[model samples]
Target: MCFVAAVVWSLWSAWHLPSWDRQMDLHVYIGAVRAVGDGVPLYEYVAENGDPFTYPPFALAVFQPLGWMSEPVARLVWLGATPVAVVSIAAALTTRRGIVGRRRQVTLTLVAAAVLMVSAPIQSNLRFGQVSVFLVLLAFVDALDLTPRPVRGVLIGVASAIKLTPLLFVPYLWVTGRRRDAMRAGASFAACTGLAHVMWPAASTTFWTDAIFSTSRIGNLAANGNQSLNGALIRVGVVPPERAAAWLVLSALVCAVALVGARQCHREGHTARGVVVVGCATVVASPVSWTHHQVWPVLAGLLLMAGPRRTRMAWGVVLLVAMTFSVGGWLPAGFARENVRLLAALAVCTWGLAPLRHRAPATVGLLPGVRLVVRPRTAMAYAGVVAVAAGAVMLLVRESPVAVRFETPDHRDEALWGAPTNGCEGYTSTLRADGTVGYACESAVDPVGGRQLNFGGGRGGSSGMVTIQGQVGPEVARLVFVPVEGTKALDVPLLPQPGPGSAPLRAPEHGRPEMITSGPIEDRRLPGARGFSIAATSTDHALLLAYGRDGRLISSGGEKLRMG
Candidate 1:
């Protein structure tokens, strides 16, 4: 039933969403992989013309299977594989075959499901085609038994070669005194990393010498680039991006000190549960988390529930909250983004401030919070049950129907580029000024009224640019006129403003006017160029957009044309 519910909910949400991310992040990357496997070059992987990806050659192996199906179906396969991989890992960590009993199964399932639901960052991974889940899962599976310790080490080694973030978990594992596991992880990580280097010699060389070294030094990014709790805090006027990193480091140090203090000062419990707690926080310390990347704590909470009792129940509740936000809450409800950061921070604090020896057995001795105080085996069973139940919920969500639809404006009259009837007449555009024939409705563009512009997905909650195509040379006709909010937008010399020694297209000195455009936008990196891309709904509560070929290529912001 839970599975059915998850399926239903997911389907419903998918259908009703005003605009889906449409594999914006990793989805596009995966799509790129598909293209590559089909013998397409990276240059050909355009979103409009093809897919979006520029992965290392190693990713080629991963994307090869995608070629067996159409793009949409391939995307589904890539996306659909996530739940299975994720839930299975959760079950392995928190629940096992001989772990728990039948009686407590339902409770375990419900709680586990709730926690999994709350894992906000995990969704980001999926949102971006990050594949971090698989990375974490490999480690999670490797960490399971003492027997596989060596192999797990090797896997970590390989994964580390691919992405640096996975390397963070190494200290946690090593500090626990599992030297052999760490060694294996190191070895595997090294081998895989070295292999990646050997295969993508150019990228590998550039990554270490350029990207990695540069990343190590440059600690902050723009608000839009930040994905951490610290980063989000920085975004909402809390702190500067670079300052936030300093504060984060200071805070982590303080927590480490506090955890030591808690060990010597208070003999309180939750030390075991706290271990996983801090793991989540560690993730939030980075600026790269999207939705799926945040799942560390949810997985940790599940494992904790199967560990000691003092804080597991509370942690379980936290999981529920995270899960709630991940599903539909990430959007629609405005608070989901910040809420996710808060939950992750709390987990980090919980673990960081608690005193637990890494090498300590993760057994449930049960000092508090368990009604029956079940045995370790029963606890394991309960945890497994919880994971399965949670998985079921995920499935049900995928199947559910949309409850209510957000209002979608009519778009029927909108001109279709290639459509037969409404097809825009391709013309060798003439550049004219004086706001005369060049800016006229029929000649330059229709000044066409259509539904308000709505970009499917844009960062920072705003829509993308509103684009309309026409013929105009920066020399004569560069003003992109648009009917914005009922008033005419005689957007000034909107092409690249005259560079040094070049002509200058200045905005009018008088009334409010759209920003100026200057310069030719020669190379369009992403597809959907040429055709106008409607960015956002304008202030007039109507629309805003650019016009003409030269109109799109404004060199105003020093932006290199977006490399497709």
Candidate 2:
């Protein structure tokens, strides 16, 4: 009870009192629910911070009730629920096969919960008010067979419906000879997904057809928080065109090794080890496994410590869990440093499976009359050869082009749009198919060239207002909209766009020469790219004039307006 108190108190201290406005994934969830209530299409709902609803429509349906509550109330409820979920996770893991005494079980659960609270992943989940903790708890309960047989797989199914990664467990159960449970999970998943289709027809169609494959909907996969194998490849400068191919090849290899290792562990009566093995593989294979998604490593370490004492495997698990605490963040930032977590996960997979190498029977060579004995080691060697062959097939793979889509203002249907570009690249806006405008960049590497300005507006469908948005070059220090009717000009400041890493522009070191500029400046240097948006009445028309830092006119452009 004291440990549980510590967990709650830790969360309260971290969250602070009387203020719950810290950021990220939770806002996306709240925005998603609000978008549904407003009758907006799920895919079209971008939170104020520019994140979209990346999960399936089933997730949106599950979260719909959150819409009824005010943001503060919802956040409070979510914050309170997170600790309960964490405690439940610890209880589920500890009580799976039963610990000796009631006292020992309670003690173990409390200790595990406290340790989990300190993990970087769980901390991130709490800070963001993310659903990951609950998802992890659900996976743990179902995977460890804590639930009754008839309803055994329901939680895993529901979890996968909310976030696609848990689907890996369905196959894990099947391959481990739990076919009945796998079928139950599959059927439950289909039922939930089918219901979501009935509730949100267009969103379901759009998601299955397009959104599932569009990596752009999620933030930059190369960001440091992303600790997946695909993320590691991306950070190391894998070319864009071949990324999908490489990801497919590597994901397949990892999944094969993981499934084999997990099956072996399950056969050896080490179910916890099997679950941990599969969990690590799922994190590595997924394209956008964020730091908060690493709940599996925490489970692995806890489960290993619960087993026999003083083994090298137990020490390896300790090393793995310590890595999950994220000492890597203190290291110098680069490709290698960025991939520390990914490498640790890969190490967990390898070391967890290392025992299989020695457990295999030792046989000399093939005889003419006798059959060749293929050991686990030899089987693994064959698997590696197959993996290499499959990767070699990447040279022949051809990718089909896919477009990102946004819902029309009417909320009736979606319109295809080009994906957003890195801020350093030049921006271009075009009237796309279905009458919606789209923007694309020329290159991801080249900096924005020359002073450029472009403006466009769309009729605000049912709201009857107008949304005017445009892009300005780095040189544009001031922009004004002068109404053709001689009304007063409206001054709109160009906001500096963050670069590729979404990092803010920084000033030079203290001793550097001052950058010369005129007019009010937000930073010492003007960003290489900037933009602005204005909300106005439909009847308004204005000429856009941009000025330089020295107060000289940079460019003048006419508003290219689109009618409803």
Candidate 3:
């Protein structure tokens, strides 16, 4: 059954791969390495889509080869490797400790891999081209006996060097009766950090001192995609100062509880369960755990199924349903639903870590009497159960479609790029009913008769020319760029819209999904919005003046037109 589900999912993913914006994070990874190669400051280098490099300096070094590859090649390599990592994780979880015979273990590993491939978090990782699954597999080396005992924790350390979250495992290894492995892991981490420092001293220093604490660089902490406890609290209206304190307190408490639970699980031989518990704790405690980082929950769900029959029927259902469905969306509070993954991880730690009164049998498969091959008599019964469960998930879960539908004014470039199309960095589409999206730099200018001028500019290349891009309001017929020092005024050209027979705008082949483009429409002249994209030869401040059709000044802003 799981194999069938996996095959179906593979087909579906392949079909949608072309339409979906693929591997945004992978681009950042490659871009960061390339930035270093180009002599750009690692932390200061921003991707074309406006994301800064947030990973450790060592990560850049690791991705240096990927930087040499073209975007398509890098994406292909990442997408292919991610599934292999998932399969490896499943194999490590199922095949270790010899719970079953070799053949049974192989079968169980395949089944687990199938279930994991279809899980929501894994799918999210694949979509974003994230490295969470690979890190998970790396952290499992010691626990699953996948490497030599002498170097069991080295991989965990290396993973930590790429990302700090796995560093939590060093102490975990210590308390779980692997003190030597813990020291080795810590030493390995230090060695990797030192290597990065030697390779790129300035970048390593910047990341360790400044960039590490700049959580905002990763994007909005309270965004729906952030499923950590800190993000959850912020969405619920906690101020930053108080949120910091509360988060620290809550994270400490969770870490304590989860660590204790993991220790118990480790001592009791449920090593995989223990590792997952620690991983869940890490996700919840982190300041920004994106949906892709919640991969541990799927593994937790699988482990939950391995418990006794009643426990499997009760807790197992609760977890798998929560994992499969967006449970937070059903809540009354708007932001509460966004933290469904966070809440689910907490629940997993709560159940997986709590001590048991009686020692349960360590059967690492599905419920008893459930076999890989079913008899003719029971085949119909299993099929009925599977059908009912599938039906329930289909009825209850409402997946947000990847497709976006919004009509921009004038409809020249119908497809908008980068999310939150508020017109700051590039030519963003605006509705222009009454409100301005605000200036690209500072100072907000009020809309004039439901008209807005959204403008931004920056240094283009080594030539030092500044490329300015903006969208002018329909109320303005003539737009002029006046240099703060020069006498000549450059007339900003308005981009023309597509004619009647022009091809309809299509979604991007590679990039983020089309952002929301529809804004309030009150003014009749809003449909005539025009774009301004020009290279300023001189790097100087300029004033943008918008003139109405009646030869009257519509709007003007000087600070908004500064050439960076």
Top model number, lDDT:
2
Model 2 ranges with Cα > 4 A deviation: 17-23, 307-324, 329-336, 361-375, 383-564
Give the Å shift of residue 266 in candidate 3: 1.4
Arranged by TM-score, best first: 2, 3, 1
Best-fitting candidate, measured by TM-score? 2
For model 3, name the residue pairs that clash: 328-337
**In candidate 2, what are the lDDT values of residues 349-426, reduced to their tens digit?**
655533557656533222335543436676667767875775455434422222111222232221212222234333
Rank by lDDT (best first): 2, 3, 1
- Which digits, one per residue and each the tens of the lDDT, describe model 3 over residues 1-564? 676577457545743675336677887898788877888788877666556788888888788889778987787777778778888888888865456688888888888888878777777788778888888889976656578987888998999999998888887787676877888899999999999999999999989898898554565665777778777765554444455666776676667556656766887787888888889988988888887887788888777776656766577667777766677667887644677778778866645544432343232212345423213223334434653554354334322221112223434221222232322222234433467542111111224545467666665556455555666765667776654321234566676433222333332334234332332222222334566655555433345667666444456666555434
lDDT of 1 at 133: 74
Error of 3 at 513 (Å): 57
> What is the alpha-carbon lDDT for the whole of candidate 2?
0.67
Worst 10 residues of 3 by lDDT: 437-446
Compared with the true structure, what per-residue lDDT tens digits does model 1 show for residues 1-564?
554355345434443443355445555555656654566544334443222343334444455566556766755665676666655554554443244775566445544543453345444544544577776666555544423533656665555555555565455445444566766777766766666666556555655565443321122332233446544443333323334444455345434432332232222433333334434544565544545655666655455445447676576556556544544344564435545554444444433234333323232222234322223234334444653554354334322111111111233122322121111122222344534222111122121222111122222133233323322222323332232211223343221212222332233333123222422212111112122222222221222232333222121110111210
Q: Write down the lDDT that model 1 would get.
A: 0.42
Model 1 TM-score? 0.53
- Give Cα-based local distance difference scores for all models: 0.42, 0.67, 0.66
**TM-score of every candidate relative to the true structure:** 0.53, 0.67, 0.63
